[model samples]
Target chain A: MARRQAASAGTSANEAAPPPEKRRRVRIKPEERYREFVSKAVELFAEVGFDAGTRELAQRLDVTQPLLYRYFPSKGDLISAVYKEIYLDRWKPGWSGMIEDESEPLRTRLQHFYEDYTETIFTPEWLRIYMFAGLRGVDINARYVVNVETDLLMPMARAVRRELGLDPDAPIRPEEVELFWTLHGGIFYYGVRKVVYGFACPIGKEQMIANAVAAFLDGAASVMRGFAAEDASAPTAPSTRRRSPGSRR
Target chain B: MARRQAASAGTSANEAAPPPEKRRRVRIKPEERYREFVSKAVELFAEVGFDAGTRELAQRLDVTQPLLYRYFPSKGDLISAVYKEIYLDRWKPGWSGMIEDESEPLRTRLQHFYEDYTETIFTPEWLRIYMFAGLRGVDINARYVVNVETDLLMPMARAVRRELGLDPDAPIRPEEVELFWTLHGGIFYYGVRKVVYGFACPIGKEQMIANAVAAFLDGAASVMRGFAAEDASAPTAPSTRRRSPGSRR
Candidate 1:
């Protein structure tokens, strides 16, 4: 038959397909494997919240518990590693990258930043740790907090200045940054309170996200305009979702 | 001598302020005692959060464990009662007082609403229970979340219409009430997040609170203005907290 003839032409039927080449042609580096482990931990954190089982976490990774022990010595170490690799590393770099993109206008970039902030913080894995650190008696205010220079606030300020063509040394004042965060907080806190207290949020989730972005830009723009002593003289009311083509530079 | 003379004229110095005259003020309605017990629970909820000792709660209240049990069957019940009283009763009512003040612009009233949202949700008792509910695995998506009606969204919409004096039903929609919750959410979540997982927040607590509020108002105004589609525009950029002069109205 045709099948027999094809098999005979390719290789002997009794001979196996050379045992899948005995090994991977491209090997996984230790860094890659370690990243894989931490990535799995993110899902585990979401599943059980911050203080759930490490043994279960290891089980989820398809490795024996001792094998996990080989990489991490303590629960604290594992959690800290999870915080560093999965949450901080993933978000911080992306934030800086967006801010550094000089081609995009400040308003658009700000919208992009809000999109990132809302998405990253609200997602289950990060949100789990975000909520857990407080009540569990963790000291989020220690030297570790001060060391976090890469936070969104500073990056945001830098981006604002960069957009305005200000010198690097001439970043916006700390008060301006503070103002931005304060307004930013109202929306953020509302979303959070709903989550923690188990309130069925009435609004559509998509609108909520879009509003967070749009409102943030509006407020921050107000702040920046106020900085220059520019008054928004209104013959006008503003729209929530649609931007005016005339307002764009 | 003069300071001591006033007390000696009417009462002994040793008399502890005559305990507010033991006459009961209100009728003993159903759940009155339950309400009193919950008031104490709110005090405790504010102090140690929801999960600490019931025996300690009894000791603090100077009652027997059995007596405490007679009023409420369990600690969770006591905690739930506190939530029902504090969060449930006044959420809608607070707006009724503010929105009816027709002299003020809707935007000013909206700002006032945001401020009250912060005070109510961020305080000790409510914040503690809010967390407890989350930790206890209460469903956030439950229908009973907050239990306020869609009527709340109406005031702002009406305010926007009257301020610009638009048609009762304009072609373009006014701001959705959904924006308000999202605005509240983004701010509240940061507070909880700071407590729960300070590791993820790049900014300090004080700064986060301030910035988050600014973000909320900015977002709210932005969404509102965007939706209103006003021919004239409010200054979008403000670098400082410029108090709205009309907020005094």
Candidate 2:
């Protein structure tokens, strides 16, 4: 997508780099060169799909394939580096702490967390690379999904429980996780519309996040209560753990 | 994505097609051949991506380039057929009727509409092709986004207004449309996780749709009322028209 170019295209440093022999003589730092490889890999992978060969990547970086290989032993290693650079590295360490911060109201915490969270994940390269990695059926998607579940969605589910004055220690149900996903997924779809689908999000990200969090908080209590009520009546219900009665016709 | 193959890799009909010369002599029906071309194109485009050439597609179908061209004058025409077959043709006409059916409670209508809608759109092929096209910067995604807004999201927004006992014709604010998108996008993200990212959705589609609809409906009233209050207090506020104060920190 041309929008992706807007993010990584600002740097002409690679294009202006000295010839391979001259750069070798100048002796770039190994760690800086490694970081350069990862960032440039993000741009290249975002521009072309993940199927791009290292030969193409090295050419674009103005470095020899051997030099690229020196940093990343293989394509898979390079891709993992890209995933860390784009997805994992961009995640704010303060997010989970924000979600569980009891001093703030749930709405304020959620709104602020998402507004800040979207700021990191909402870029063109991040969105495109994530989609490209998923489309290629890489483990990057699955791994990120788990991180979101454990670090983000599950913690928010507990936050919702505590916010509603329900027992925070009560085992979080699959239905509860599903409920949080509606809010998380809804906000994510805004990013997809803006970055992936190249559609206008009309509402700016701040307003969109606020509207989503407000709507979700409004509906969450009763839905959770519905789950609680169902659990109370049939403590041993086989299907209760797996599916919500509300989902049925 | 392997899940995509699960949907389209069913029949060996193409694999067993007669030799091209024999097939030409056998004289396949024009409409039947056109339909075959479209379905096969979907499978191939979903597998390799939209970058596939006419020659490769014809070879996959066990037909000559000339014969394939007879059905679709150009590659774009063929791609258009795939879009129509996968996207437009899959939309059920009765969805809007279901959404507006006041005899049913708004939650009931929404839960039912989404359950049925997700069934139609949540396939692996549909999910992958849409992402692939969007990644390639095609108009298919833009067109589908509009269709979702005008045909689906706007109607649901209006439905939310009607459900909340507001003026159904109350000139739907962008905030209201975005509120509907939170629900719509949440459900759509479930599909993305399941189909595009190849992750387990845990809850079934029916439950996911139900949970999303319930949450959106739960919060929608106050959110809409908040909009109504803002509009009445400041009829001509320029900033009010563009951004929701709820979105502000």
Return the lDDT, model 1, position B101. 69
Model 1, B69-130: lDDT tens per residue?
A: 77777766776677677667645566655854677755456556655665666655666566
Which stretches of model 1 miss by more than 4 angstroms?
A: A1-89, A117-119, A141-150, A161-171, A186-211, A228-249, B1-40, B43-50, B62-67, B89-92, B115-117, B139-153, B167-175, B186-249
Candidate 1 residue lDDT tens string, A20-64: 544323445767757767888777775556656777876676555
DockQ per candidate, 2 decimals: 0.16, 0.46
How far off is residue A162 in model 1, in Å? 5.6
Task: Report the C-alpha lDDT of model 2 over A21-91, residue by residue, as the tens digit.
Answer: 55443468999988888888898888777777788888777777787878777787888889888876788
C-alpha RMSD of candidate 2: 7.4
**Count of clashing pairs, candidate 1:** 74
**Model 1 chain B poorest 10 in a row by lDDT:** B240-249
lDDT of 1: 0.53
Candidates in order, TM-scores: namely 0.60, 0.84
Candidate 2 error regions (>4 Å): A1-27, A53-56, A64-76, A236-248, B1-26, B52-59, B64-77, B237-245
lDDT of 2 by residue, B1-249 (tens): 111243344565756544335554467788998888899999888877877777888888787778877887778788888988888889887888888878978888888888788777787788888888888777788888888888888888888777777778767777788888888888898888888788876787877777778777878778888887788777775244455646664
